[model samples]
Target: MIHKAGRASRAAFRQADDEAFGAQQNGSMSKSMPTAVEAITGQNWQSIFVPKVNCCEVAHADRAAVLVDGANYFSHLEATLRRARHSIFIVGWDFDGRIRLRADQPADISPPLGALLRGLVEDRPELHVYILVWSVSVIHGPSATAPALLGSPWQDHPRIHMKLDTRHPLYAAHHQKIVCIDGRVAFSGGIDLTVRRWDRNSHRADDGERVDLDGTIYPPVHDIQMIVDAEAAAVLCRMAAERWSDATGEKPSSTAGKNDDIWPRQLPVQFRDVSVAIARTSPAYGGRAEISEIGTLTLDMIAAARTSIYIEAQYMTAPAVGDALAARLREPDGPEIMVVMTHTSKGLIERFAMASNRDRLIRRLAKADGHDRLRVVYPVVPSPQGQTQVLVHAKLIIIDDTLLRVGSANLNNRSIALDTECDLAIEARNEADRAAIAEIRNRLLAEHLDCAEADMAETIATEGGLIAAVDRLNVKMRGLRPFSAMRSPGPTRPIFGTSIFDPVRPFRLSLPFVSRGRSGAWRAPEKEL
Candidate 1:
């Protein structure tokens, strides 16, 4: 499934008898993690749901802007930098110059965003640019995944001296995406610019040659992104500066990527009047580990939505979070929930820590959906070998269109509690703002379902949520269905709630461990039920 650079083959996700994603990490079970209530009951989870940013004001909060996904956000960001009048700065878990912003063009010209900066520097002398990637371990397991052949092209770029962040706890990463142009617009989401991630709205699952990463076609990938202005975007820029300094041992200049003529070159796109918050999840360099802002924000968001919660993500594997969602859905008046993500099978990387947890994960979400308010799904690609392409790699959420969360975080244990994730949320406090958010959410759904936004809204209204609407559509048009998997029927043993209260997540001593396919190490993943 490397996509391009090789023949397309459909191989079943074989259950490796060996451990997945490297070596076994042995630590003191009793003292390593934090405590959690077995049940986030009526009152326990109530405090977290309140809107962090009150969006109820009637005046026009800045509308009409773009919010980019971290994965591919950098592509258009170069356009932002070329157009800046005041400043330019960035933050993320990993920043690779080998990734071309305009992959469709020549390498020397589009050698990632860094070279473009050098080129524009002569034309627009006022522009300044900065970048901050995570300080992951040379440990390699969950840290960096750069392509070997391309080499580090950004290293030599004049305007951009990329800094790798090392200011984090033992088990965490600096995972946030921010871009500010003249301090007017910003973007936040999960898509990254590495390899094998480029695709149009067609979402061709089997077509790997379309969205090429390194000039050669890769896979049928997809990403969710947005644009924003002033209010939220400004905060994101500040966050980037903090991280930039943390990595470089120097502060990001106020005029990092500032240019005058580039502003008019890029159109100022608008979405909705949504209030957003920018937060980080980095613990002290070591000592008592703690979940970052991203995790806290998710739990808080889950508790806030009154009607429904719809999410689009790349990966999914968090048990306490799954349990929290489940506990919420049990409420007679709890909001419905729909999770859309790629279905990573018992892959070599995921099997170690999550093998036993998969069934539990699926079953928990499934059982929650059984109540008619919650469901989990993944994008699919049609192929003769019966293989499915679950490549919805955008991390976003539309909560009743009243709240939108976009950033570099995934809905997994690693992202929630381990990685440094960042997101920008828009709170549609008024009727008009809510409508605009709804409009965009439906538009995105239309792209996925291959329909018009108007039609998608009607479907959402008809079925109550996209998950139900998709189910209803599959029932009627079985053949037109994209690749997908519905929530399974029941709970699996050793599931999130099956055991007594343990201060920390239950880690298995017997489960097999393995390193990532490219390396040789170990991590935790699900085993058998």
Candidate 2:
């Protein structure tokens, strides 16, 4: 039986859907689509960003750019780090001290990350560096935990502080990847500063540059990051400081007055003078309330899409998100939906836990795709050894050129409610903003389809929709391929169905000898066995 509150919530969502699509039913929405200005500043179209509901805040950015792959993101990050003066904050799920920020540069100039940070502090006496990483990274992450737990030469400086965060609930990870320099510039997205996450946009299968510190070669990968300046940077700085304080019980000095013009000169700007929203996900623990702003914002963005919804993600096992998408697919005149994900999970544990669950969700969505409006795919690139998949590690979404989101959250149960995450979003304010957003979306699709951005745009225009364009251009050796649902073996089926390994909330442990009364008070069992 559905609870009263659940019924009311469904009703509210239905009303919102009707209001958003009413014009289409009257046969005028196609001709009367809201202009960019009207969608952003007018009351007729309710904005998807609502403070304390879907996002923490909406702040203005002087400039913002999308970094498509590691080759682009790392070089720009290296340049921006060189200009830091007062403070730097690095927060992530994992971190490697041996990785070079600028792999193309010589070792003398672009040293390992640890050496570079030490050099920066030595050269600038006023500068301080702080790094926070998840405590459980030692068990399952790519970075070596020995140096992080014990002291190393790079971590000996008094001005440099590194701490492992253990404040999350059991099985939940601290998954935000953020970097703020002097409160002037900030980066937030899926690309982590660790092993097996660096690759060029070309995604060449045998690229010589894709090697780890131990000389182990890795397969091609794909990810994204976003850099922003002005008020947006300051907001991210504050958020990082708060996380640092929550973990270590020591608040670093405020970065209020150190905002200098430190935007990377070489990075191209995607939007100027646009508003950006910061969304987060933190589970309830230790008296702190749960915050699922990113989850709520994703649903709202899906509900508001008028033409298409594009996504690239690492996993696709979030029940609520799958249900919302299924509902959208059930609509007769609904927007087209496309999702690009990894072809296979990485390790044995990931295969057992995530892969099986992913197939289940895909099957559910397929059942609800009555209008043929859904396409789930994986990207593959040509290799001399045959075709190899470009591992998708990006968390991105584009909704009808009206919204763009990039973040560290995966499309999984933990990211929806249990894990910690941070996502940056931009809502198009005018025609220029809309065009910029569309260009980024097209650029990503072009990279996947192994074509030029101009060609992608022309094909989409010619074919009348994204699905048609993809079909028309996906004949090359390197292109998108559809995903097929897989059935797990007998032994693992029940384990995956229980969802114990991928719980959506913190584990609640209770002793067998105790019982909870109707008033929520713990007491001894009336009849003990």
Candidate 3:
């Protein structure tokens, strides 16, 4: 199927490109600027940005809460799993049953993750759990271990159904990390149910708890997760069921029970009866249509911001998002943009693929900051020994006080086009909702700046904006550091990360396809994923 589609796509795009570029003097053209009111209202967000083929339904969560770090997310998720009654659904890019759920806490008197699930099924005759994981390639062996090689403990219980999804095209991954419990509560975010992902909010440089299966401590990592209940959870349940059917050609006959509310007892509820938008990204394969709602919503969020745009992610190299931000920076009354990222890319391949294009985007954004409204920074934690750069692996964005998004999708071309991802967003509908959203943003800044939330709020109130607040409180040693431009081969150099490794499109129509030649950026294909 992919081979036939690849050939048809290449032939069609070639003919279309020849005709489109021949009629135009310059191929690089910007989209029309939307009015401030129209942008803020999000009127065109559904009509213009999102592809019509996506079936992401709008739903409401009776209650919702935001979890800051791995400590909070893992602990609460464990509790929710314990409270499950009818069904438990988990979908992810990776899942290791051997990993401990709460490693920081005592050696869980219950059991390891795999054993715990088995025990749960053994105790409850009616409860069933379904787990779906990507069938990763052999090259990823160092990072991913085959469960079957380790005795396949997840298959010990008949009630526990486990499957590997190999339905996506080559080089594409099922990158979403989601768990739905009893059709009443759901969790979606970047932290996978695997090892080497446990850290407290303190982000201490030498914490002993950041360990893996071998008890080897790793670096400090930071991420976010969101918990939702009620209709929102039901919607996620349907999404998971669809994927299960697509992968195995059989749908499990389990449904979420409305009477069984699996909301964690300790987690505080932040909002009640709020609308939640579930966005997704999938590659075009088999007969399934591709969806790219995450990228479109990202562009819309940037366009609609009135005061500020706060972003924290592992990568910042998406050309469409960069263009929208650059357009905003060119405006005199545009909102202030502040981006928090990791100090450096992790491995050599990541440095070339991700950091190179990131350097280019930062330089380009700086050039467009005529009013000095753009600030790119990375956070560092102080220690008695030395400073350690905290790995900012959270995918989050806050636009003014009106919109908040947290999820598994990063601000990269792979997330936007070639990888399967999921994101949850909220749009404030009233003054109270806006204040709650603002508090979350302020709390995140407080965590990064190592100050009280009250203090951070006061600083923002007095300094007039988030950028000014960070600058006023940035005198301390353990705080955000400005991003310095590094020399690449050129402003538009095509590195492997930005080119071959993470192509902008999922189709294998060509070796390398350029979204914009002058900018040297890749965009998702109009006719492909």
Candidate 4:
């Protein structure tokens, strides 16, 4: 039943896989990897964004911007929500109604997210708001889940509907973070509208405003959210509505006639008149075909990179991704790779499972980096207490100056094939678009290095590449630090070593002790340590 385009896409992927295999067997990628001459001459420049293979569709976006941190994303989200005249749909792994979208402002002026939504619905008769959060999040998420499970004043209104999404397989989470306003604009990325998530771009170690519901100050965290308008936004809006309908069995009213300009005036647009591709990762369930568009897109982008590949992720234990990066590293003239991740996972369970696997993958990648073109580090900021590592929660990737992707899917097995995820990607088609994408990458590197964007760009030019520039600029009190393998202690290691906590596919109670891997092999999941 596959169409011509699908067959062509499959053929392209098969060719890539065959080339990679040949390179591995030959111990050199001179025949497979693109040469510097070809890259510079712009010869055989085929985009990796193939619809039905790496993405759902490529839609036109009138305007788009990458919100670097939580501060920018939350502020813009609040503004856009207030301007929603017809419909507002939000989907997230976690959503705390008690958290203030704009904590910098007074409570009276900028109320909590729940209170703000309540007020908006009360003021506008035609306006309706729909929120969907993962069902299991009520148990594993923050304290705000109690209010959502029980009755709350904010969701008491009929116009404001909140539902817990239980449409996925057991142990599979709905991990997408998306917000669409009146079908005019949409926000999608890693930032969740929850507590302990908001922090300024400065990432001061001791920000007074970065606190939880109980007023406990949390460590600084960094995340990204990409905002898009026009047809792209409408596509996301439809996706969000479809998710709601699947979970709640009620299709929300369409926003056909409610075309209010909801783009936040304060937010700056990074790109205009661009093609935005929507990638997703959804587990197969209820007769639905599994979608691994994000995973496929990530591999294709890595393969297509000519100069550099920049990544910021919360976790780095996806086996296929590690193998792909390792293969690239073995290339004598491969693109330089820079990865920014958290110093350590937050909870004990995560630390035991994710950290061990992360170190193992890092060691593997390090071993394969024969030409030393890889740099894996975590960001830190100077506080009054001393230097503290900033919790990097952003899921972002930049392939040279050609492509930019931001989404909720972490570099983990669960995100690739098990959990539901969404990512927004844009490919540069012109010089202006390329410049904008490169500037955004520079801005992110500057934020991590605690240097000016212009300085980062200059350093990259002077040092020849991003890896060299990072090496030069990372000698500061607040900057990136390399990771080292650390042994996990205790017998709980073995319990968590299994993919029981982070399966690559849907969980079946009948086969509770086994899980299906990407290769369609049934094995007892165990993390290599």
Q: Using lDDT, give the best candidate's number.
A: 4
**lDDT leaderboard ranking:** 4, 2, 3, 1
Between which residue pairs do clashes occur in model 3? 353-497
TM of each candidate vs. truth:
0.72, 0.89, 0.86, 0.88
Residues 1-529, candidate 3, lDDT per residue (tens digit)? 0001122222222332223222222323233233212331333233222223222655889898899988899889999998887888999877777777787666656357888788787887888899888878223522346573444755777788888888887778888889988888899988888766778998887787787667776778889999999899888888887888889998876767645557888988988899888889886777666676676667667766788999999898765566677878999999999999987786787887788878877876787789988889888888776688888989999989888899998887778667899888887877877888899999999988888899999999999999899999887767888877622234632343344664655655543464655567865444432
Residue 264 C-alpha lDDT in model 2: 89
Relative to the true structure, how large is the alpha-carbon lDDT of every model? 0.52, 0.81, 0.75, 0.81
Worst 10 residues of 3 by lDDT: 1-10
Top candidate by TM-score: 2
Say which prediction, candidate 1 or candidate 2, comes out ahead on lDDT: 2
Per-residue lDDT of candidate 1, residues 1-529 (tens digit): 0001001000100010001111012211111111121223453332222222211111222554433332334456666665665556656555554455665456665565555655655566555566666656224422235522233543454555566676664445565655556556666666544444545565554454354443454445567655666556555666677667756678655733333433324444445554555644444333434434555556556655677888777665554456556667777887877776655544554544454454556575565554677666555555566534645668887777666777777766556434566666666656776777787677666665666678788988987776677666543211123222343444343333212111122233335564343455565544211
- Indicate whether candidate 3 or candidate 4 has the larger lDDT: 4
Off by over 4 Å in 4: 1-46, 257-259, 486-496, 509-529
TM-score (C-alpha, index-matched) for candidate 3: 0.86
**How do the residues 169-203 of candidate 4 rate in per-residue lDDT, one tens digit apiece?**
87788999999988999999998888888999999
Looking at candidate 2, what is the lDDT of residue 371?
Answer: 79
What's model 1's overall lDDT? 0.52
- Point out where model 2 deviates above 4 Å: 1-43, 257-259, 486-498, 512-529
